[model samples]
Target: GLLGRYTPLDNGTDTVDEVALLELMKKTGYSMMQENGQRKYGPPPGWDGPPPPRGSEVFVGKIPRDMYEDELVPVFEKAGYIYTFRLMMEFSGENRGYAFVMYTKREMAQKAIHMLDNYEIRPGKYIGVCVSLDNCRLFVGSLPKDKNKEEIMEEMKKVTEGVVDVIVYPSATDKNRNRGFAFVEYESHKAAAMARRKLIPGNTLLWGLNIQVDWAEPEKDVDEETMQRVRVLYVRNLMLSTSEETLQEAFSCVRPGSVERVKKLTDYAFVHYRSRQDALDALRLMNGTLIDGALVTVSLAKPAAGRDGGGATWRHGGGGGGDGLFLFQRENGGVEGRRCTTPGPPGLLPAYGAQRVFPLPPGTPLSPSSLQALKPYQMSSYVSLLEHFCYQHSWSPPDYYLFSTPGPKILLIFKVVLVSTQNSYLPDKLCALVEDARELAAQHALWSLGTHTHTHTLGPRYAHTPTLTLWGQGTHTPAPTLELKFVQELSIILFD
Candidate 1:
């Protein structure tokens, strides 16, 4: 009877009648609280009930702005018991066109979604209903570099409600500055959602800069099952000059053969150990330790879900970058105590055996019978020649790109480009079943360089070439056109 007197306008922009709204709230036994631009109604002042269960909340959107709870509640309650109703409002008293309704039981929320989704509330207005994910974190971007945690929290509280905590990542280059963005955690999902709406582009400015806002990507939790298989550690904040050999030597001190492999990226590296215990020991000793005059942070590397079982890419935190470690294990689905011998160059010496195997894509069909490994003589003749030339010329390392073509028979394409000179070369001979793509590609590169009868002077230094590709070859696979360029300047001679 009381709700009948407070009918909303069709245009939905009418100023709210606070006195009538208060009377309706009291009559309906609903408590009310108002914040910056939202009104929450639930848990009546003198009443008590159990809190809404998890998964019992439904998000209601596309509401008619003029509509109020008195008109909206009856329709929502038709499916279940109401625990709380939060209507996003504006200073002008019109509704913000959306609301969240939590039911006492999860089944009621599900039923509400099934029954009222896309239900028409008026002649031309249909409201959308769905499960609320209940995320309580927000990603705040474009923050002033100089702002600290304390300064940011104070500023956020002035414009929004339910300010709880701000999480800022320190810049790798400058400890005093943040990484230009921070994560803000709210006490509840409702508060975070309200802050997101208020902080959206063009709505507000923080520290004289227009900042960006969105829900923070939740970090995946690592479980005991994952920890059981972890033999890798993600190491970050490394110096760009750090080499794989340097890191391998540093990590090997835990025990003989403790460090299986080390992959050094731009400013970080991944260390694979022979056992999980070895990984644990390395992490404890290496984390927060100084290497090459830089403090590195080490953490357990968790395998990303849904990646290939052969090689699962792992990440440290939810975000990518130095924290992410890409690991490729053997196709046999084993990461411990397995070793394969890789022969050196052909024609130069005897085949070397009993050496450790490098990582490869899983289920790859590169068996011993299918392909012959490279010989020692051939490996040294070509690779050593180029290495000597590079050393003599004071040239940077050559860039290589490796990728596989899609098919029943995968084609490995290896492309190498020397940064200094512009000359391109293709391999005259093809080899198959090599364990390391990089080594095989280097042989092909040297063969292509040797076939050239004429010598050209090295040129000026240029920008780094695009990534080069190296592919594994089959016995019957035809050789693709390959280009090798040396762009740097030096006096060079070629002999047939």
Candidate 2:
């Protein structure tokens, strides 16, 4: 499968299973293949007969990454006819970074290695080739207690190339079963080194254990308490298309032989390095490299919880008020997380009677002859000044709307809407604002006595202003209950 169930076919479906003969021609520089009657079906002159058997297989590294097997075949076919091709893949269907190519003859296999080895398939990227090693050695640990030498060697061989011998260390209590570790010998040093780098980190689970690997012939066996753990890198948001091989290659390019172990999970992975410095080197090169079409992020992992005071997480507060309203959040001396709310414009205030309105006198209607005696006030001018005052306290600008005063001496009733952008208001602070507004009105020589039966229509949207007459009967005595009520309504809307 080429990363997905379907192979990209030349037929134009971009499908799977069908090989990309054209891509092969372009990369390998040849197209002819002898078919049924000794006739070449392709355009160029090429090799004779079908591909060879499985025994003549060779491993190729650093494939022009993200290429499907069908396309990769041509890159190597330049050396010989492909018998069988296997690009090892991760469980998620991503290439493992290396592939095995079987050819028609031993000579052809050798030819491929020489011609394709270190070939720059793409800019700054080259292919590496290796013949299967016949004798090599490796260390394996975390084996099940019942595992035997033969079983361990067989298992390792299934994943690695060339294996001839194995040694198991048994527990003191029994010779029949091992103490969870063993040594494996391959056909050559090359094979041993390959296994050491690829398998030693032991993120791959085997026989139910995430087995560990190192040289059984160790440089030293220090006490467990004195051993320092390997530095690990945390990689996240891996695309399902990313292969273990691609990731490993990216990290290895940073520092050769630094990546010791890799364990991949649903959308993340962990890469262990031999040393912290080497891990940092790997991070520098691979922190944002794209693999399988997705950019991956890499960082050093923090120690697990309980290691260094259990890792505290802090979040920054949003500050003051936000969104459609503001909340005046504060922590009282003893009580915590208390908040206040600000009121909206008069007509916009909640169903409660926090808003007041007054109507113009019926006999004193608007006329050009009478206009000279009345003073005009800009809506925004006063509002801007009021906003400047409240903002210092972290509140939003108030909305002051003026409708004609009805049946009265020419007085404009401006509804002072001290809207809290943070959706909160302190009672003390709100009253202070009302007092300031009254003073400002008086200073402008447009002051009107506070009273009931006031009616006002600030704009065209409101056909008529609601009458407020309760204050005359002493039913609403609280100073600026309108402001407090507005704040209460805003708070309800905010918290709800």
Candidate 3:
């Protein structure tokens, strides 16, 4: 006995045991072979043909006003078989007077030249057929202002009846408007050739204007390694007095191999590096540092390349200043240039001792003779009293006022002397005084509580200092740790 294997055919409406039927046919003396003794092999089970290659070139042409694919494809197919046929349609679904015919064979495409070249498809109007390569060379002009990459693809689909890859140049400031042109790529050279033949310049009208087409310039090819190595760093909030030399000197500490170039951009600078790692390292070390009392920031820079081409051009009117772009100038003798006559806080009174003295308050006045009588207390207490007076009045007393006032000023100076006589041995006495003054101001709503420092000490000596503490109304105390403990405390307070 012989074994026969069965196979089933699923034909949508029904399933049939194809192998069993074949076996029965074989048993009935039917031969499973072709007439020439050659075995015929159909397509493999469930195997569809290969996908159309992407990025193939195609040709497009403007058709005669009355001619269409029905009349067009046969003309080409009669000369040579066609791969696909299409007629471009407008948004209104009317013919746009253009069509594409893709040939199955390149030689058949060549044959179309002899048969259809200048051949009349209608009265007094000769049809045009071009090798797909010619079509690819024609540039598309007058692209719809509102069309994007997707919309371009949809419009081109009607011309080629094949996959299209379109790249559009959009305006830098307005994305919805075209930058006047676009580049379209086809999946087949035949399709590109057809496009060129049909889309004749000066002969086709799109949006009521005669459109032009030409090969777009190829994009500049930059090596991946070179691109990866090039980095842009943005440096912002620079001091107005900061010069290019100062910026360079600040970044000079970075590893020699890291930075490639540095250019100032208005209030900020662009720092480039050989690699992202170098840029990142520079950012970590340079951000938040004081440069002329202003904090500097650093980050990765953007490349100056365009979407259509890899070359970068200035987006603004003026080219960046030759290496040292000064976005602003420092005035020398104008109003802004005048020296600040404003005074420092009164707690720093000794710095202003030469200034005229002011009378104390009427409730507790001070005089030269009484100043000696109250000098026994520690210096810290005197500083604290003056700080309290300045905080209460929202004034810088020692530097701004003198013996002109006979009441509040005299009383404040007397209180300062009396407080000095009452305390001694406060280690950070001046800082404590300032802290107490700030707290009193917070309590009275003279100043917001948000200005309070966490550990009330002289601020960092650096030009740029980050927030040192959360603002609050409280007695001053030293923090044992340098970490941001107040931030955590504030978060808990907020949640509660």
Q: Which candidate leads the pack in lDDT?
A: 1
* TM per candidate: 0.39, 0.23, 0.24
Candidate 3 minimal-lDDT segment of 10 residues: 400-409
For model 2, residues 341-370, the per-residue Cα lDDT tens digits are: 223334332332443345668688664643
Q: Which stretches of candidate 2 lie over 4 Å from their true place?
A: 1-56, 89-97, 104-107, 122-125, 132-496
Report the C-alpha lDDT of model 1 over 1-496, residue by residue, as the tens digit.
2222233567763456666677777787787777645677776455566687667887787788888887888899899878788787665567767777888878888889789977999997888776665567787766777988899999989888898898776665665776667788888867877887799667998877677565564443333445667888878777767788999999887998888777765566678887888888989999999888877888877665424211255433313111222344546643322111122334323333334335788897864531113433333333444555555567644444333322224333233445344342333222233234445556766666667633222111111122112322334442121111111000010100
lDDT of each: 0.60, 0.46, 0.40
Global lDDT of model 1: 0.60
Give the TM-score (vs. native) of candidate 3: 0.24
Candidate 3: list runs displaced more than 4 Å: 1-138, 161-163, 220-271, 276-496
Model 3 CA lDDT for position 421: 19
What tens digits encode model 3's per-residue C-alpha lDDT throughout 211-325? 4443332222233334455455667666546776777777756775465655564456666566667666777888878776665666544333423211132111111001112
Once superposed on the true structure, which residue ranges of model 1 sit more than 4 Å away at CA?
1-132, 148-165, 170-177, 221-224, 249-256, 306-311, 316-496
**Per-residue lDDT value at 409 in model 2:** 22
